[model samples]
Target: MSACNAIASPVLDPKGPIAAAQTQLLLDAVAIMMIVIVPVFIMAALFTWRYRGTNRNARYAPNLAYYWPVEILIWGVPAGIIFWLGLHLWSATHRLDPYKPIDPEVPPLRVEAVAQDWKWLFIYPEQDIAVVNELVFPAGRPLALRITSDTVMNSFMIPGLGGQIYAMAGMQTRLHLLADEPGEFWGRNVQYSGRGFADQQFRAIATTTEGEFGAWVEKVKASTQMLDATTYEQLAKPSVKVPVTYYSGVQPGLFDSIIAKWHGDGNHLHAQVTGTEQAR
Candidate 1:
């Protein structure tokens, strides 16, 4: 395969600030580890050559048992590296949390994502718009995503966006992200679902300006298609490699309804959706 075809992962080509930060962290960790790794490898080669049986004049101490300095060099160095690694992990975990909001200066765009049988359904509740296998938003604006699954377990991931979160039936998960510049990024289900899992992919377009994003929404709204209960039921069915689709209108509270279905009782679902559920 050609080099272009072989390089398909977006994690290596980050386009967002969060992804860039993550990439830096990975590089830093590897570089720090090599400090000890490289020296150990070099010492191994040197010791083997210096202590070779062919070297008749080599000095040897058969009674040598322990050396405090050597012991400290072996154990202390690795312990210190592990300590630094722990500190970095703790800081990164909180700083890059998926639930935390991005830049406060830019108003966040709310998006509800549903992982269906073999496709992605993105719903814009504020705009009353829904699309299948396509996600579009304005660049430089924070994106707050509420994700869930209608059928089975799945994961929602955009490699250029940094983190991947699970979307489970009956439970809602949150992810916050933003695109530093305007461009199209790849999104897919990293977790295996079923037969159509390989074909499950989507394009996430980040428009350059708010006006362009507004125009795109207007164009979608002009479509005649509607996503009511009946249409949604059909969309929830098993399918493979579905094309991008647009819906001018979406049913109200549709996302909540999908989460409620797995709760069994209506009250529990309501409480869970409304964030009022308490420990039993």
Candidate 2:
């Protein structure tokens, strides 16, 4: 499972600002921990060799239970490490908050994400378009995602872009991410929901050229399929390994309506979406 997790998440190869920052924090933590680990390993090897039968002169401290120096070395050092690590984590947690806007100076592209039983749905509210199993945005631009699950709980992640954020039924989550360059990244569901969970994957395309994303959006908009409440009900049915599907148009407030289904209070999300849309 550990090896499978490593293979599934390509977090080491960070392609975006958030992922890069997270990778650096991981490296820093490991480096700090090695300060104690390396010394403990060296001392263990030395003690083993010195106490061997071949070395009869080795000192015996069988009656020894407490030594202040050793006590300080063990407890004090670890306590200090804990203190340092806590400070580091406290600072990083806020800076790398998933909900925090990556670049406030630049208006972010808003994308609504819905995790279904066996596939992912990405709705571009501003563009009035939606796609399944594919997410597209411009490179070097901030992307703000509003996520919720239409089925069971799922974790939405693009490992090279940022950390995973949970998408739960009835509740919305926010994740802000940015890609530094044009490339294709894999996005997947980290939580196991059912048999189709393994095939719940998507492609996240980052376009770099000016207007390249617009052109791609235009291409998607040309698709004949339209996603309305009826179409969505049919699409919501469980299916495995669905291909990349695009809907040129979507029913207005469809994403909000899905969230409203669980709460039975349709106006709350509607009002929130309206305020944010107006603010943006």
Local error of candidate 1 at residue 199 (angstroms) = 1.4
lDDT of 2 by residue, 1-280 (tens): 1345345448888999999999999999999999899998999999999998899898898999899998998899999999999999999999999989998899999999999989999999899999999899999989999999999999999999999999998989999999999988888999999999988988888998649999999999999998876588789889998899999987778887788878876455445545555665
**Can you write out model 1's per-residue Cα lDDT over 62-90, one digit (the tens) per residue?**
99999999999989999999999999989
TM per prediction: 0.88, 0.91
lDDT of 2 at 258: 83
**lDDT for residue 154 in candidate 1, whole number 0-100:** 95
**lDDT (C-alpha) at residue 176 in model 2:** 98
**lDDT over C-alpha atoms for residue 130 of model 2:** 96
**Per-model root-mean-square deviation over C-alphas:** 5.1, 4.6
Error of 2 at 4 (Å): 14
After superposing candidate 1 on the true structure, give the runs of residues whose Cα lies further than 4 Å from its correct spot.
Answer: 1-9, 61-63, 265-280
Lowest lDDT 10-residue stretch of candidate 1: 271-280
Model 2: lDDT to the true structure: 0.89
